[model samples]
Target chain A: MNMNFLLLLLDGLKGTVILSLLTFLVGGTAGFIVALSRLSPFAPLRIAAQLWTQVVQGIPLLVIMGIVYFGPAIYGIFAVPPLIAATIAMAIWASAYLGEIWYGCLRSVNKPQWEAAECLGLTRWQRMSRVILPQALRLAIPPTVGFMVIIVKNTSISSLVVGYAELSYNAKVINNSSFEPFLYFGLAGLFYFLVCYPLSVQARALERKLNVANR
Target chain B: MSPIVEMRELRKSFGAVDVLKGVTFDVERGQVAAIIGQSGSGKSTALRCIDHLEKINGGELTVCGHALHTDKPDLAALRKDVGIVFQGYNLFPHLTVGQNITMAPKLVHRRSRKEADEIGREMIAKVGLADRWDYYPEQLSGGQQQRVAIARSLAMQPKLMLFDEVTSALDPKLTGEVLRVMEKLASEGMTMILVTHEMQFARNVADKVIYMRDGRVHEMGGPEILSQPSTPELADFVNEEF
Candidate 1:
């Protein structure tokens, strides 16, 4: 095996970083809408959001990626790029979980906050934008940030379905050629740790800050 | 001047339980009425019903001659005319004192930032917290936060204020501070409906005192009624350990 392990590792690390960043950016925004939709006044909107979350949670990530990669073609649209398919799949997954996380925070806002805003002559939209969302976002920050680390880590699975050249995919390719499972996998795990640990720490620190602010 | 709010035969229930039954009251312009009651006597529910926060199962509610029970009772207009100070102070913790005061004015009144800021600063000064405008709710003492909550409500220029046990959650010293602001408001002729157990403050600040018992108005009269302490039920209940 004349493979360069270091080159494979570098390439994989880049994939991990790119995929995680893209997923976080796109996924976070989509998740916000899902969260708000789950709380919508329209019963159909609420049910749609709820069903979307349940369906995403039930399906395996690999199957979802496959569906995303292929489903767009049935409509005769442009061929969904492998990276785009993986990102969309990851975003769907993230929206479900993040929506649930934020819905919990939004509900945690004491009932009086809603009543107080209502008495202040605010419409439902005004109550949400002015009174409720500001408070909910504070409670949501820590958990949302924490869930982002999961989003980052899950990007590794994009390698399984799309065979995207993410760190995990590169490591598997390198190990198959060189037969050095321990070294290649260990390096891949190290790269994952390097990317995720700081985020985990920041999430925890933000959680502490939220607690203090709430207290 | 006309009565600003009137609730006639108001009735509300939740499933098998009745929270308020055939409750009747009127709040006249520039009059402060204090409603005192034991826990679960429907004082809070009545106040919520007035705000349409809880729709009455049956009865007529009118605010400034406009009916409150209609399908669309001009909610924004009604709420604009009525402000509330909650038991928990409920100041938006994420916002500074100034922002909290200015929020509804800017959002509901569509006041410009400059105008709202000026009003917020002026009210903060009135509440004796001009220096604390930039501070967050958590940074202030409970009393100070409650004062800011009052100022926030005042910024809306409400025709009536509903205070639900505003000082119940505060320390004794803090309660005094909050009551002082309220007393000042009452003196300034702001119509207010307050739910409280502070016998002294109610007697001193209110033009009328209402006692609620078992989801109904048990008694209503001048401040002298509370001072004399007539009913055995009232005396027993007030003295009982909660």
Candidate 2:
């Protein structure tokens, strides 16, 4: 209810947004590469990518944050910032899930399309870029937008280990000082909803629009 | 003159089953050859092997002067000279008909956008879908989509075209439209090889007819071979409703 409390929450919200965007940008690029490698013709490359996804998905995110934050110091590089450490951990976590999601989307493209492109004499890259990727990207959009909500929520975990001071962290601080748990926590929840609701709506809209078979 | 496509004792096996067992055939320049047979007779497999869509296990195979029996054939160059259309009409659903037709010419041939669009329009007109150039594959009927698919292949100016049951998915009315376009291509002196169920189209349009049975050329001759098949397999295949 107080101005100072509101300002603290808003400041934390900014950090949350920045962290999510940065993690997604880094993670999304890495995920795309992983997805391509999973589908690569070479057995070793595909196995390597598959191993990465399996290992990343197997570990917990909080543990990943701790290791990333502390793993550098074990090597005698002690200058690692909390924000950088948290971002690195979150990115690794996200790329595994996103890579799997995108790999499924890429595979969902009909087999005949690949054949058609092959018969046209398009190179391997051309078949992917001109035919396979375009269709896969359309199918990928809805799930990708839905994944953004997960990214926004997951940023909160960074605050637990590294104390990155995102919305949840600030809410805990405000509640401890004022002893008004309901007010601060409710306000934090509202901020999270405001950030995530639009993405959910957009994802649903894309699912309907891209469902061309029914149309 | 050398044939556009020549297969001498070509063999292909999927696991334990042999699909194309020592199939021998030739498709000459400016000739239309139709391979007709019952299902599972390897007519489609033979067509796919010509485009190098299916790798051959043994024997000699050549298309557009490129030998395919080698470990590393120049597939890109071979494909550039050869075009293929499938029964499914695998037009990129996300792209418009014009975009689909112009993709190869622009990318593979490196044609300018203006030149590609010009070629797109010409091929679209050739298939009687000039007005539907901007439509997506899903927006068109099954037959129209197949026509657009044909145009997409034709835009590359291939030396030879292969069609694998291209009209098998269509109703009789729609099939007529597609067969008419193919008939026109035959009259224009374009070399083509088609695996079709439409015996009437084969008799009317194909200069040569091949009847495949159990992965071999059972009977092959001029269009009259349909009416007067020398072998019982060819006679049974020609008389069947499929």
Candidate 3:
């Protein structure tokens, strides 16, 4: 591709990175809360968190973006900025999957650890933060990194309907005028592979290292 | 002072199964009581109830002046006064031995870092693992990890300590080392309750020996009762143990 084509793609990559980071920050925080809620002693909170996961997983990321992007304007009410709308949809979607993944990690830490923490007079918060989370976080790294790869790729779908100016969106616009679909889209595909393949490799490495420790 | 622990007809049920049926026992301060029984005899369940790890379904339970039979006992306060170690060791796998020993002191007791470090060192030394303070739980053998678990409990400075089949998981060599730490603690006059299969250790170290059968105290007396035949069931039980 030409320098101009390369620059446009670089700009799109920046949008994707920013979206992915924001999604991880916002959605990762929510996912932690949801994971805690899933294990919460209160039945209602546990049930509500379960419902949230079920409902979100039932809807695709594209549909979620459409609902957040268009559902607001369809009401002809308060308008959301495209970036904000995309972040909100992508974050909500990530929280459900991340929460479920994290809940499994949390539960996998072993039952006696909970009892031991409790017998030590640790407050529930201390028990979670100090004792349980440290172990769970180890098991969570691989799956969480794997999920982020999914998040980076899914940010592309956000541009299709939400008009977020991400990599594929920019490539499509450039290809429409230039009529060089293969060159531009191919380059966009390579950029995604560059960003995502490392994460997958890292996830695999962490899984192996941690499973050995666990054994 | 009154007994450090008093269970007046304490009853605990897991659904339709009554694990502890109207069990009553008392452990005075500085007394090491050994609870010896078969797998289903509820020795472990009784020890668990003393710390309120398992809720009692019927009767009164009091530990370190905290009555636990009620709906809401001050668990934080009760736990501050009681410590329990499980057979699994249950050491926080990610933390170093020093961190595992210091966690409760720092978090629950809110000891400063310097003070917590001091406590961690002292407790680990008591378990004869002073040099391994920086090592992770996984780095230690089963016996060493169990020793670290004991040190973790000791850092809390509880009024009572409970050991639920602590040495049951270790080999004979490892079990001896762990039991030595426990024997040292008993000599120091720690108020302790242990559920153990080690009949010899029970006879030598325990001030009181309780024999449970069918989720009830079938026979109870001094350590000598282990050698003496008070009941046919206990006689048979002790014979089988030997």
Question: For each candidate, how many residue pairs have backbone atoms clashing (under 3 Å)?
Answer: 0, 0, 0
Q: What residue runs in model 2 are displaced by over 4 Å at the alpha carbon?
A: A212-215
Cα lDDT of model 1 by residue, A78-143, tens digit: 688888988898888887888788888888888878877777777889888887888898888888
lDDT of model number 3: 0.93
What candidate 3 gets wrong by more than 4 Å, as runs, is: none
Give a tens-digit lDDT track for model 2, residues B71-138: 99999899999999999999999899999999999999999999999999999999999999888888
lDDT of each: 0.86, 0.92, 0.93
Q: What is the TM-score of chain A alone in each candidate?
A: 0.92, 0.96, 0.97
List the candidate numbers ranked by lDDT, top first. Answer: 3, 2, 1
lDDT of 1: 0.86
Steric clash pairs (candidate 2): none
